[model samples]
Structure formats: C-alpha cells, structure tokens
Target: MGFCGGCAKALLIVFNFIFWLSGAAILGVGIWMIVDKNIGSYFEVLNLDTHDQFFKYAAYILIGLGVFVFLVGFCGCCGAIRGSKFLLGLYIFFLVLIFAGELCAGVLMIVYRVQIEDKIDDALESSIKKEYGESVTITDAWDVVQVQLDCCGGNGPNDYVDSKFVNKQSEQMIPLSCCVLTNKGTAEENPKDAIAKNGTACYDKLGEYYEKGCKDGLLDWGKEHTTILIGVGIGIACLEIFGIVFAICLCRQVDREDKY
Candidate 1:
C-alpha cells in the first residue's frame, strides 16, 4: 500500500508538470493570436463591424483559460507532493470546471463557424462599399488578404466598380493590391509599390489582376487548415482529461491513507 501510494503520487506530480507546460504553451498561443499582425488580418476578414466582439472575446477566453490551467496545474503538483487532501479536492474541482468550459467553447466555435459562413459575403460587401479606402484598418485588412491570397475585391475587380474607393479615384482604377506585378522593373519590387504590368487602371487590365475573389480565397484557406485546427483541439482535450484522471486517483489514494 505504501509503495502504491508513492507511485501514484509520483505519477501525479509528473502529469501536473506536463499540464503546466501545456498551459504555458496555450497562453503563448493565445497571446500570439492577439498580437500577430498577419493573424490579425485574417481575423479582420472574418470580423463583421456589428460582430467584432467575437475576435476580442475569443482571445480573452483563451488567455483566461490558460492562466486558470496554469494555476490548477501548480495546485495539483503541490497537492500530490504534500499529500494534501484539501488541495487535491480543489484541484479536482478546477479540472472538472475546465473540462466543462472547454466542451462549451468547442460548441461555441462550431456555431461561430456557421455564423461566419452565413455572414461573410454581406460583411465583405459592406466593407468594400462603405469602408474601403475610408477606414484605414479595413483597407489594410483587404490589402493583406488580396495580396496573400492572390485575389481581387470581394468577387474580383468588377466588385469594386461604383464603390467608394474607385469612385473617389481620379483615374479609373482598382485597388493597387489588385494590380498584377509582372513588369520587368516591377517584378522584383514589392507588390504594394509595383505598377500594373498591362495598364495604369487595374479595371482595364483584366488579365493583369487576380480574378479570384477574396471571399472564396478566405474560405478555401480555412478549409486547407481545418485538419491542423482539429488536431490541436483534440490534443488539448486529451491533456485536460489526463489531468482530471490523475488528480482524482491521487485524491482517492490520499483519502484511503488518511482513514488507515
């Protein structure tokens, strides 16, 4: 019995250490998502003006959960090492709470995915029509997407016609981001600064601009990375479950030793 208890305690400590590392990793990822400019551009594409809270809330939740997990892991290690029944019980409680919260978050993510699919077109149209060239944030976001995805406007250069950006231009033009950079002097230059290969006005140079629309480009990009996302989610869930079981078993061992 003494040997068994010692083994359980040692295993629990090791598990908690691993859990602590996982928490730190999650925290780092959460912070990165919040601050990374490239990632922020992707979020901007998904974020509708009226539904902008989603991105902020998602980041906050990740940060909060990461911190909570970090603390719980520390508590779990202490409880196992000192054989403190009270601390063990508290650790178990926190583990269960985190498990439940993660399930809820998963469901919420699925719902958010659906909502994004339904509203993305409308959001893109609204941004192009009213915010393009007018809102620096929106314009930068669109430019990033257009260049990275090799796409034009929401549905190609035609989608920009009669829009605020095009209307305000002195010459008939699409966004510089839409222009294809293939000229001898421009091919090596930055796409943002490169002139169009065929003509100055991007709308007239149909062959010189990307015909793919950003709307489809964004969706396809998400699909390409779905497997990675799902794998990460599953990995975290397994880690949480592993922590819960270890804490519970150690608590039982402690209780039996106390009664003996």
Candidate 2:
C-alpha cells in the first residue's frame, strides 16, 4: 500500500474507533432501559395484547445491535491496521447486513406511521383500567409521566373515574401528581392549594387537575423531536456507507500490494 492507501487506512481506524464507542454507548443505554424500574414499569403500562412483546424485546434488540456493531467496528479497525483481507471482507459483509436492516426498518416505520398513534391510544386506554395504586411500579410510572408531561390521564381526568384505583377509593380523585400546584409548592405541603385555580371539578367535587391529556402531550413531543431523530438516522447511515467504502478500498489495496 502507498501513501494514499496508508492515509485511508488511518482514517478507517479513527472512524471505526468512533463507531465502537458509539456502540458501547448504545449498549449502556439498552442495559439501563432494561434494568431501570421506572422504564420497566413504563414498558409494562405500554405493552398491549396486540403488541405485547414490542417494548420487552426492543431493549433486547438494542443490546444485540450494540454488540454486533461493536464487534464489527473492532474487526474493521483490526483489519485495517493489520492489512487483513479476510477480516476486511467480514467487516464489509456485516456493514451490508446492517445497512439493509436499517433500510427495511425505515421503510416499515414510514408505512406504519398512522397505526403507531392508534396503537399508543389503545395501549394507554387498556393500561388505565388496571389498579394503579395496588402496584407501586404502575403508580410510580404514572406519577413520573404526569409530572414530566404536565398532563393527566389517557384522554383527560375523566378517564380515571372508571379506573379500578379511583373506584376503590371512597372519594373521587385523581393523583396529586396531576395537580398544578400554587406557587409551585409541593403537593404534600398544601393539598387543597395544589389544585389548579381554574381547574374544574371531577366527580364528588374532586378537583379536575391537569386538563391536557398525556396522549396529546406525548404525540406533540414526538412531532417536535422527529426532525432530530431523522437527522441522526441519516448521519448514522452515512457513516455506515463510508465505513463500507473504506473497507472495500483497503481490501483491494492490500491485494494489489501482495501481488508486488
């Protein structure tokens, strides 16, 4: 290999190193999602009969992809540095597989875009019917969601009236997390004042806290972040293309050098 080939090899090493690090980060995120109680609860709530295993298997798939990418990146780096044609060929094969998988995934997401919203709504409705207070996990998930999204219920506070938890309680009420507190005081500090000033009444004169439903809030959030997600996806795809090209070039250069 000549000067240009050496430079290409060096660039490949740097790119593969970065790719390996990214894979490591993805693996860490997958592990965190799987182990975090809040995430587990959130997945449990979202899981539906139609898509019972989607969330559960998503984390596992992420971990698998992370491991695959990490191994491929490592092989690319080693192949480039050691001028190994066999390892370079292996790296190219994996890159093509990954690229094809991503392309299919992107196509599927586009085709099923409308169904995604319907599925989310159905899952949310199904989740709300269960006993929220009985399970600490479910309760915690709901509280965090309400607080973070600043919203109530699947559709509205009314959705809670039919909930097993709300029906079990003597007084008709929503979770304190739904309330928009005065002066941002803690719900424990002033339960009465925690209720929003303009909030309407639910059944039995219980304050109708947050008017906005999580469904809209979550959908809006997704809409806002879609551009960023697309950009990241494109960037990753470009990186994969570049890796494949460099691997092929290096492999050819190594072959030519062996003939000389």
Q: What is the C-alpha lDDT of each candidate?
A: 0.73, 0.70
Clashing pairs in 1: none
Expressed as tens digits, the lDDT of each residue in 61-168 for candidate 1 is 778878988899889888988889899889888888877876776676667667877888887787787878888887777777777777877876777877899879
Worst 10 residues of 2 by lDDT: 184-193
Q: Pick the candidate with the highest lDDT.
A: 1
TM-score of 2: 0.77
Compute the lDDT for candidate 1. 0.73
Superposed model 2: Cα runs more than 4 Å off: 41-45, 48-54, 108-113, 130-137, 181-208, 221-231
Which digits, one per residue and each the tens of the lDDT, describe model 2 over residues 1-260? 79878987988998898778767755775687667654454455554221246755866876898899988998998899999999999999998898787677666655554565768877777677674777665666666667666777878777777688787875656776677655344543333334554344533435646777788766665455444545555666788889888888899899999999
Best-fitting candidate, measured by TM-score? 1
Where is model 1 more than 4 Å wrong at Cα?
1-3, 49-54, 182-195, 198-203, 223-230
